[model samples]
Target: MKLYISLLLAAICCNWALAQSDPLTVATFNIRYDNPNDDPHTWDNRKDVVANLILFHEFDIFGIQEGLSHQVNDLDVRLPDHDFVGVGRDDGAEEGEYTAIFYNRTKFKVQESDTFWLAPETDHPNKGWDAALPRICTWAKITSVNAGQTFYVFNTHFDHRGVEARNQSARLILEKIEEINTESLPVILTGDFNVGQETEAYQLLRTAPGMKDTFDAAEIVYANNGTTNSFDITTSTERIIDHIFVSEKINVQKYGILTDTYHSRFPSDHFPVMAVVNW
Candidate 1:
């Protein structure tokens, strides 16, 4: 009986130590889709740079926008230790751009996952609220193997051309978050929102109950530049559209816009926004 008690205590302590050791590194990147018009910035040339950035930064999990099926497959192949959860936005299959969330398979287990359209008829794939294109939010309930803790992650890209679509999309995501997270677990939201901090849509998300933007909440910040470079490595705009937001329970430690470049060239049109958060 004494040996059993001692073993039980040791197991509890080990789990506690694992849970306390590290904060999760999360990022949101809009890896500009494969376009021949992009020329020097096409996926073939930029994929390696993007992969290197993620690997070097050691992002435990990240959300990517504007990645098509082939692009997603490229990342999946490049990051052999990681897997993603999402679907194409056009037909709920591999037919269009994806707002996919990728997690380190060695460190995390996906417990639940789904993709929902940001439309009035969310059950199907269709343009919503006068949007020029259909948009989607891909989410997952993931469990950290190291910490044995579970959290929810929501990743998305809002309609870039519609004012009403963006606003309503924000509301729809918030509703979905609340509806799905009945346990009120820690939530991390990442995306390329395509709107600056001053916009109403940005305000809606920032002001939402229990949600705090990591850029604003982090104790340390670096490379605090605008997220969009439009493939211009030298331009440093002050407006930031990419964002990472987390629940109040999560402690945001550091935030940054990863302005990594390769031979003076940007890997993508938008720089990734990253954060370190702990619960």
Candidate 2:
């Protein structure tokens, strides 16, 4: 009986060690753009709130959608411990909204980074495929400072008004991932996809080979509702458009849709989706 107990204890220890090894906390937040019409919930009112949430959660790396250049600057000032990479979608040079990736500078080292428009002319900025507005994706090849592990992170905000644009953008991203990741490193994709899970565009990404939704793959989950709240606590939380997908090589230990609010108001219209993963 003592031997049996010892073997059980060893097994538990092994499993715990494996789960904790090189764990990374990643999140995707669609912080509503700094729109003045969203009064009472404008960026000025919620900038610190958003920064506080990121700090409190201790996110190692996170992607933000719908943040303008000034908003990014605000976060940069607030989160001095971290650094971000990405450019505005309008001109690729800080003119429009940014799909930015923020990382803890001391925890990870960026090996390479760039942004590309989600269009046939990926090399330059242009509206693509019946899109209402131009859209872009920002990606980075990052290495973990502590573990010396490298992976790719791609972040984007899909065009909300264009159905065809969303579909084409999804395909374009898949192709780009294949092209850019020559090392075949593990990939982490996060974004405000702007479409529900039932949509074809979402399904295309969800069914992509070597990719898995972290939410579905996690061993522990804390999602009680959908991601978008639209600043109204009474809003229906049935549609989850924001997402995070990872290469199959990574193991997602836990996933959550953080619905944290400040003084009964949301920091953003969309709730941030967070995952704890390890390779």
> Which residue pairs clash within candidate 2?
none
Q: Provide the RMSD of all predictions against the true structure, rounded to 1 decimal.
A: 2.2, 4.3
Residue ranges of candidate 2 with Cα displaced over 4 Å = 1-20
Superposed by TM-score, candidate 1 places the C-alpha of residue 95 at a distance from the truth, in angstroms, of: 0.5
Write one digit per residue (lDDT tens) for candidate 2, span 1-279: 999999999999987676449789999999899999999999999999999999999999999999999999999999989999999999899899999999999999999999999888997889999899999999999998766789999999999999999999999999999999999999999999999999999998989999999978999999998999879987767788999999999999999999998888999989999999998
Q: Model 2: how far is 270 from its true place, Å?
A: 0.7
Alpha carbon deviation, residue 264, candidate 2 (Å): 1.1
Which residue pairs collide in model 1, if any? none
Off by over 4 Å in 1: 1-18
lDDT of 2 at 161: 95
lDDT of each: 0.94, 0.94
